[model samples]
Target: LPPTGPVRPDSYDFSFDSYFSGIGGSGFFLGDPKLLAPASTAPTGAPFGARIASAVENAREGIADHIRSSIGGSEGEIAAALIVGVRAGIPEAINESMRRTGIYHIISISGLHMALVAGTIMFLLRGAFALFPDFSSRRPVKKYAAAIALASIAAYLVISGIVVAAERSFIMLAVMLVAVLFDRAALTMRNLAISAIAVILVSPHEVVGPSFQMSFAATAALVGAYAGFADYRAGKTTAPPVKRSFLKFLSRKLAVGVGGAAVTSLIAGSATLLFAIWHFQRVSPLSLLANLAVMPIVSLIVMPFAVLSALAMPFGFDGPFLYVMGKGLTAMIAISAWISDRSPVDAVGLISIQSVLLATIALVIA
Candidate 1:
């Protein structure tokens, strides 16, 4: 090795290093790591990859600066995290609060980010297509929208630096878009399986990481739960053609929204419970309650406004949107703080391996 510090192979996380070696990369570098001044632009005559990376970095930094100016606090950091999938500036106190409340994933680019962005793109594109009635009526406008949404998501994946969690979400989103093209179900177990397999093949070590394990475990449990209950839901829905007054329709829609939120929180929280305990040495007992209280705001208000803010930044119109997103995040922070305070005793010790193995067998049998 070139002029390096003392050999520190023991300091490396062996599993991570092993994964790197498995992919034909050296886990250790040959020289002392360099500390350099930050450059605002691409290096002179850099290659294509370097240029694209620099542009993406600039875009992210621009978003971060805008958030700093408009929101300007931990809330602003949260906005940046949600908007650009960057979490570099959040305070440790707030981070722990979120983790304790089980909302830290909101700061990461996970399935929720992919779903919100792709869903918004699809909705907008389809609505725009529908404006031309003659053309929309004749063409597969939905499929066209799906294709465009996929392309937009791909661009986002590149912008987000294609991290492991984002990569998994992108694969799942791509599979769903392709299913749209073929007139098939999008959010099914098969798609989940395919995405999981793709991620495993690309980064097998990710299967051992918290991001991969928790996300896939939560998703698989949700899929299986829904599949098991599908027949009952279908039977109940078979008699749902009755005409209703506007008030009743609104009430029913509200009920569905509330019920869906509760079920989703319960399922995702329970599914990831073991992983949480194993990794963090504790579980958020009120995770479902926290998610139910905060996520709709994050999904319906924060994420949409954040996307709009990012898009509007180049035109100097992002301020109001960023302010709105900060307001939503402030509410989320308050909720997290409340939960953390009220449920101080919710944390538990780490689960034993034997118990985990037994639970795994039981889960499989179930």
Candidate 2:
């Protein structure tokens, strides 16, 4: 292979001979790789999928370049990772800190990112529709907003390079949005199951991968926990409360928000515990504290600015938004580093297959 040509990833068709690794005593190795043919130069030669992928790659590069030019430095790199799913420029030290503190998913395009994007779009669209009383009174504005949000997420999925985690998140979110269109419950176990089935059908091998297992586990646990909470609340009846002072009301709302974030961190961490041990052989004991400290910045400031900056990019108004977003990113990184420094050393020894299976079974049952 030469470096001079316009060679796409899928441009070359190659064949290789496989052999057992003599020294490693595990896995096979490829040898004597041969290039069979280059991609066709004809207008209609490339496969549709390949062409779409190429365009996506180009878009990702363009986005990355724009982010770098606007933000610069590691913040720009993090922005690129968060928005376009490109992390090649992020320093390894920062990545290690995030991984140790268990906030690495902030940089990874996953369910949280998808949810934020969809939720923001839905919120804005619904609010806009609500301003028109006549229209809102007569039409199913929620369904229209959901439909548009779905389309936005589909575009986001393509922009993010359609990785396994992003794909799974998109499927789950798309199902929820579709449920809204049909006036059905969106976050039920049935919808989760449907999303899981869809992902497995598309990439069955991913079921055994860490991204698939950890993602689904966390989602299942969160859904089950919230569903149980909803049921419990439904069963309990309370008299109407007396009105409180505005300060008291605000404090109570803040408390509830913090409590919810804490509960979410605990649930997701517990659900992914076994998978983390099995795949990475480490656990962040301070992850709950880290999430509590940093998630507000991410959820409230970083992601919102990310969305705003993206929307404003075409009009050359993203500079200020990106600057504000960078501040939030800086705070998040600092918090993660602080937490990582205090985190306990990695847990020793590998967990056995039986233990992993048992934990997985227990998770499923729960």
Candidate 3:
């Protein structure tokens, strides 16, 4: 190996590496310019990891272009993933879509996207399985579908390499899977406890990393928020949806996405401040608004192509879909770049690690 600081291979928590690559990519692509100096654009050509990332990204680009063309096509889930999974090569129209919305880039796949993908697939598979009465009526297909969902999620985790989210999602899913496989009803807290214990035992240091802390925290908060929303939507009075006009409807969506982006940025931003103060010296509150506008498109448009592309390539019939997906994903990327290039985002400056960590702890507790 080339002479350098002792190799601190963070392999113990590969999940961190996955998440770092994701947010780090976003930081490089859309983050404030002052954050990255000469090294920001350093070409990691020919390195093993770079090669792998490139191959995957190249596939993502193909899938994205395909999705863009075949608006309604086979493997639309994968098409969707490409935009969310890899935002590096998005084009124009998708970008415009986001600019109109006003949130963050939707490239980073999280619990929301995962749940959607899983839910979509489960429904699809369930419908398919139902066609065959024997399979449909035999045993609870939900368990088998859940296992398939777990497998699909694993594929996503590896492909996206989203560290913290992948790890935690995998663990939680695994717990659920065990219960399903054994035909036992699961207790959520008990499963969660097992996952937590497994995570620490596997990599104690992950407790200090942004991926570990932030992923868990965000998952918990979102889950809580979603539960509240579900209950409220069922009957209780809650925050009313913005009144809908054609133009106003669009604005409300953008506002909703921006709101989500703000929450995400605050969580992810705090993690960054704790782990790498030198890299991020200030925080930009407006980033949430920007993110909110853009993120929905990224999730709905850009990232889903990874799986979609893979699904389409087999019969050599994927080219057209790939082209469309690529175009849309590329459009999404181009918009983010355009926005970054023009009225680029600015930061609020960095905080001390201790302060960041303390804030993180507080957020988690709350």
Q: Please give the range of 10 consecutive residues that has the lowest summed lDDT in model 2.
A: 12-21
List per-prediction Cα lDDT, in the order shown: 0.81, 0.85, 0.55
Report the lDDT tens digits of candidate 1 across residue range 263-311: 9889888878887776656788778888999989988889888777767
Ranking of predictions according to lDDT: 2, 1, 3
What's the lDDT for residue 78 in model 1? 83
Q: For model 3, how big is the CA root-mean-square deviation?
A: 10.5
Model 1's alpha-carbon lDDT is 0.81
Q: What shift in Å separates residue 333 of candidate 3 from its native position after superposition?
A: 1.2
TM-score of every prediction relative to native: 0.86, 0.87, 0.57
In angstroms, the error of model 1 at 338 is 1.4
Which of 1 and 2 is the better model by lDDT? 2
Count of backbone collisions within predicted model 2 = 0
Cα lDDT tens digits for candidate 2, 5-25: 213332211121011111222
lDDT of 3 by residue, 235-276 (tens): 966686656789988887778877766776665544443343
